[model samples]
Target: MTQQGGTWPDDSETVPLDSGSAPASFVPKSTARRAQSTRPMPQRVGAGAQSYPDTSQFPAQPVSASAQGGAYSNGAQYRQYQQNRQYPQYQQYPQNPQYQQNQQYSNGWQYQQYPQYQQVPAAAPAVAAAPKRTHTRKSPKHGFLALLMWLATAGIVCIMAIREIPFGIDGSRWVPLIAGFVPWLAIASALFLLLSLLWHRRLLAVVSLVCLIFQVVWHIGFFVPTTSLSDEAKQAVTQTDANGLPISTDKYARIMTFNTTTGKADVNAIINEVREQHVEVLCLQEMTEGFVQRLEAAGIDNVLPYHIVAELHHGDNGGCNGIWSLSPMQNVSGDLVEVDASRVAAATITLGDSQVRFVSVHPSSPTRGNQGIWGEGLSSLSSLKEYDHTYVLMGDFNATWDHANFRNILGSRFVDSSQQSGGGFHMTYPANSKIPPLIEIDHIVHDKGVVVGDMQTVELAGSDHRALLATLEAQ
Candidate 1:
């Protein structure tokens, strides 16, 4: 075979030997580029293939040696062609400039000038910073102590109420009346504690209601006017005349006792009732000079003129005791009984065919600072037993039947005209309030010789207590 001018196989070098061997046929790299370009692209392989005319720039492919080993040998173009026959239509674009320009396409990796979007620096992963710690505070045990102290103060007030007990020796006993505050405070405290203990249940509500009722009952007895008397010592000795003549019949007298509250509208109402009822004897407590003057001006005669105690010093006389009688009054004296100055008097009156003795007393009320005085006054008055001639003892003793002192008086020989005649105890307090009336603190008590004819609560004036009226019959 004749040799070509200059070009040789890229991987081959000529050697002067083996003249008897057969010469192989040459295949140009251009032909290979054309063949590769004309072939269809592979379906699975995403990699693309391009062709060049000159082998000087294109990468060379290694020759295969054996079919079993996926290699090639000399004079095996047919076999090699069959091996690469999957891409038959691939063609080289070295001869076509227009095709080369068409091949310049944007792959996924190539970028176009799309408004020059600046590649923002990728934000570093945010560090999970540790949560900031804060210090906390709390109240100490002393705070609890402060709260307890507040509760204790209220508790003490309640206890004071329970300690007050009504204990007296006679019907005219006033000891309990004076000592009422002690038990009152103590009971209140005990009740308060009980309520607190039961607070979590429906029982609490029930207990609270019970306590309220009990307290109401207790206060009704406390504030209502009552005369503590013992009948044993107050026996009506005899009925006699002013001349010591014994003339007796079933005749009686009307007596009334009232608390006028400084002679306001209440006193006027009391006086009006007394005038209407023709009460033979009228006893009033918490008397004022203006009120007495007004009553005197209103034709109230035979008033016991005496200044006893001064609860208040308003207008030269505040809460003083006085008695207004239709009969000639005697033994009119106003002195400090136990606490403040008070009035006491006796009068002999002719009732129809009988002569009756009337004793009026104004005792100190057991209120706040006057508790001691009330107790002493009640006891002192009960022990007097000075009158025995068909006498009627009536006044505002400032104690209630529920009190021990009042019970003691009941035990005495004195008869409660109201309880015996008026059916039930009549309460007279907080005149304007709608709550139930309290007790018969304003009272009429006499020895068994004097029978209770009638008893009632008269019309009220501007006073806190309604007027008490009683008619007694000599036995």
Candidate 2:
């Protein structure tokens, strides 16, 4: 056996722990040169020279300071390999920051792991996948919604802007009639504009915004005027009589105008309501001979003693209008004015030295293709304005403020009693039917000085038409 520092009998070497070296025979002089050429070799003990390399114990080698330049001693390197067995030994070949962190050993030894025999192929350099292009596109749903909103905009604009453009046919006039509600259509368009903006539809928003502004400017009056009377007339509504009491319609006079549906009314109910409600003047439409007898039998004359009945078109739906008064009618005249297939009655009643003229006007039903005659009824009634007394024309005019023809014909000479008196839009006519009146076809049109303090609709039995009672005071 070899003793420490002893030369073998064959003149072999001995281990010297202080002299920094690896086993001289196991590692070639070339490896030693390479290790020393890359770094300052660390302190190590050289193994004694042997014929064959030891299988169990690796040769001790110099410790290198930097892993980039050198490696650990062979024994320490085996230990590092055992510890990092999960990773490949070629850690430092493609040197990077990640390799430095992963190749560090717990024992403070650091080394590269390039394989000795493996040769890296020099193929074409890898081409990193071009970064996938990303793009933002609007959803198809967004486009569809924008389209729908634009249709809504076009529809509203067509109704409002093109309605009044005269169509060649007579039936086409219904377009303007229906388009009278453009105010409502414009409001809906404005709502759609808001919805379009919320959904981020840029094109739809711009288009709808433009249409909404135009319509809003065109039909700016969104709400009903609280008072249609002039500033002076409105102030006169608060005036007091000479007696210092609030000179109101209820003080002395209340007038009622009604289309009794060809006198299919409860006459007893009418007479009783007149007496209880203190209705001084009553204008009735569609009164036939049998209807007058029934009204007389029910004692309507007991409540209103004086009356002027116009039987011009008696027996027809447009026939038999009467103006009945509680006071004796001074200038009672049923021939106030005449229109074919229509009836108009007028009378003057004395009220505290003031004679108030009342007229019963029944325009032909605009339905049944008689809109022309219906217009004529309103035209003939316009003559009542020439009366010397304060004029009160009331009955079933068969027209609402929605009727542009009625409003145009009346012009500035009349005020709608319901609108002027704050009665609002009360629906009358077509009463006693399953679906009650949804429109105000009956109205009271009066001259300026006649103040409508109150207007109400009364439902009566056996009559398709309801009654309108408008209380009045002279301003």
Candidate 3:
């Protein structure tokens, strides 16, 4: 029979033995394995429990697993060891709960990843291309502006062409009258147009540009050379001298004046014209020594052998005024009336039986406050008693008839050969430009002479001004 404190069958009751036989003891087969792991002793009871006993064979208790608390060596360690063993078995039901949570978390992470990749698709390439197109647009603005400027320039050129055709008539009275205003009008209009364009005023630019073009075109034909009388016409127009010789009956005294703009006078046309006309007299301003020498070498020396030179700088090859006459001169003395170059010389020339006097004079221009060259020159000469003789006073007065000095000469007994012989306004000065001629500043003044015929503006062969010619009959 089983004694007290003996183990019961792990399955249920103990196995049946013979009826009288002592009940067989129940023992676990895995006890030895459990004892090895836990170091069991003979005196322990309960499930999986072990006890260590004292042994006398050794000096001290052997380091048994039970005394060491089943490999941990302390009670707390034994408890932790027990907890570690219980965890794996206890975790089985908890695994099912975690499965559902893992499924939810995995789906959420996948959803977030889908959006991040979608954001990288079409949007990134579109953003990168935008600035490149904007840069390309900016590059063509300069080209567009250049095209606009070309259009504006072409419009101006067309306008000028239209205005030139009507003004080209040879004897048009309006030729010289309108020629003078074109330059200032062009300059003013151009300035206005540029300012308007700068302000982005399109209409103003167009209007100003049109006006400027019109002014330029209007004067284009006014410069056709003046209609000169044919050689046959000139011969028919004059009466013969007492000797039955052809009289010196030219209607104008042609003279050319130049500033020369330094020493270089590049007037091939004037030089050629002078050769062609065999011009009887020539007058020049701004005669440098080099120019005089060049002119002399070129055979113009005969027309102006007696030259009165004024070096504007005392020595600087500047402001030289000189005269070239066909007739011989005598008693030539140049007295300083206002300044050294302001002087007059008298000469006697026999025109048939009548002796006529020729006086050549030049006075300072109204520059740097010298306000009265015309007045001073005329007044000084008219006051001279010797001038009572039949005289022709000729030179560049540097003042028009509008000035008191020129008017005094006109208002006094002296007659302008152009008015008495020819008709209308004879505008001179500013020789090379196409501007309207204003004020007759150069003149041939005579006293008590009958005007024989017409006045003429000679061809512009040289200098900035055309020469004048007139015929006078001494009674």
| Displacement of the residue 128 alpha carbon in candidate 1, Å | 78
TM-score of 1: 0.45
Q: Which ten residues in a row have the lowest lDDT in candidate 1?
A: 106-115
lDDT-better candidate, 2 vs 3: 2
Q: Per-residue lDDT tens digits of candidate 2, residues 1-475?
A: 3333652222233222222444233334333333334343344557842232221243333334233222333334444545454444444355656545544533323333433313544458889999988855768886787777778777876775554443222223254345445545656777787877777666777877887787655433223433443444334434555643333343246678777777778888788767655677888888877888889888876667778888645435545888888667777777678766555678877655566778887776666567566666666776655656677778777666545545654567777776656545567856888885766778777777656655678887777777887566654
- Highest TM-score against the true fold, candidate: 2
Separate clash counts for every candidate: 66, 0, 20
**Which ranges of candidate 2 are over 4 A from the true structure?**
1-252, 312-315
lDDT (tens digit, per residue) of candidate 1 on 72-182: 222133233343443222223345464344334322112123212223344499999999997444345544644463465445444334334445332233344444333
Candidate 3 residues 439-468, lDDT tens each?
565667677453333455653534555555
Between candidates 2 and 3, name the one with more favorable TM-score. 2
Q: Judged by lDDT relative to the true structure, which candidate is superior, 1 or 2?
A: 2
- Top candidate on lDDT is 2
